[model samples]
Target: MSFRVFGIDAVSYSTYSRLQKGLHAISMMIIVWLMTSGYFAAYITRIPEVKEAVSAFNVALATLFAPVFVFRMCVSFGKGYADVLRSNDVMRYAAFVVHNLIYITTLIVIVSGFLMVNRDIDVFGLFYIPAVITDPRLHRWFSDSHTLACYGLALLLFMHVAAVIKHHLTGRPVLKGMFF
Candidate 1:
């Protein structure tokens, strides 16, 4: 099927924005659940199996979303990076840094997770993502790095949400950009 918006033979900008926001919301919810499980469930639980399950789930979810996020970013921020950097607007420049920080921290978390896995993972029992790290020391390093990167991502996410609320509350209606 073919579609057009305003005589332009392409999807409308609003439709693209909605799709991007939908993907972001879904991905963030998964990531938050996985990240929090590591900090909460892994520690309070007495059973080894439960901790292992959470660990496995985190890695599987992170692996699955990593590429999808990268593609979403590329599509959403076509020239915004360079344009924002060149602009004199302090808010825009700061937003750009925070935005890139989220991406950098996410990639770090994913890569560090891949480096931390010790055994081949059977993702939801559908397919396998093979172990990428073997050495105990290297695995430990990656594990620590993964934990730290997850924290970094979490902080960036909080800031991003607060910023949106701030803009919306201050008569900006930035949230409307995502919906309605």
Candidate 2:
């Protein structure tokens, strides 16, 4: 099935499953929020209370998101890989590379963020996740890794958006395939 808007045939672009689209939308929203809030809390604020609140909220959201993200990775990775391997098109290959990089970096960010916590994680005061690493030095290392991975993920996200815009401008609208 496909969609038509403004005389454009969406099926001629890239069609994703409803499940894929839903997962993509949810993941995108959460990731964008987390990244924005994290950056704001880290760099844009001098108020300790505001920073703490943002950090707590982000931690809870991320903890809940980790499993969902892993599920998304499992669902999307193989299909993306197969598409790239089967296609001789350069654009396909490039898209696959960039998409995989985003996935890998996101995974790193989630893992490192969890590892970097030196204390138990309180999820909206409902549950707690105990810190796995006890060593302060290891925590610092993971914290650094999380920050670096976040920067890399942000760059890749920009490239992904740019590619989507480029495709749309070239008269092939891929957004229709990914959205309702």
Q: List the residue pairs that clash in candidate 1.
A: none
lDDT of 2 at 49: 100
- Please count the clashing residue pairs in each candidate, in the order shown: 0, 0
Segments of candidate 1 deviating more than 4 angstroms: 1-16
The best candidate by lDDT is: 2
lDDT tens digits, residues 70-94, model 1? 7777767654667787789999898
> Which ten-residue region of model 1 has the weakest summed lDDT?
4-13
Residue 5 Cα positional deviation in candidate 1, in Å, after optimal superposition: 25
Clashing pairs in 2: none
* The candidate that achieves the highest TM-score relative to the unseen native structure: 2
Per-model TM values vs. the true structure: 0.82, 0.92
Error of 2 at 82 (Å): 2.8
**How many Å off is the CA of 79 in candidate 1?**
3.7
**Per-residue CA lDDT of candidate 2, range 1-180, in tens?**
676756766664555777888899999999999999999999999999999999989999999999999999888867766767988999989988998999999999999999998989999989998989999999999999999999999999999999988888787887777865
Q: Residue 144 CA error for candidate 2 (Å)?
A: 0.5
User: lDDT for every model?
Assistant: 0.76, 0.90
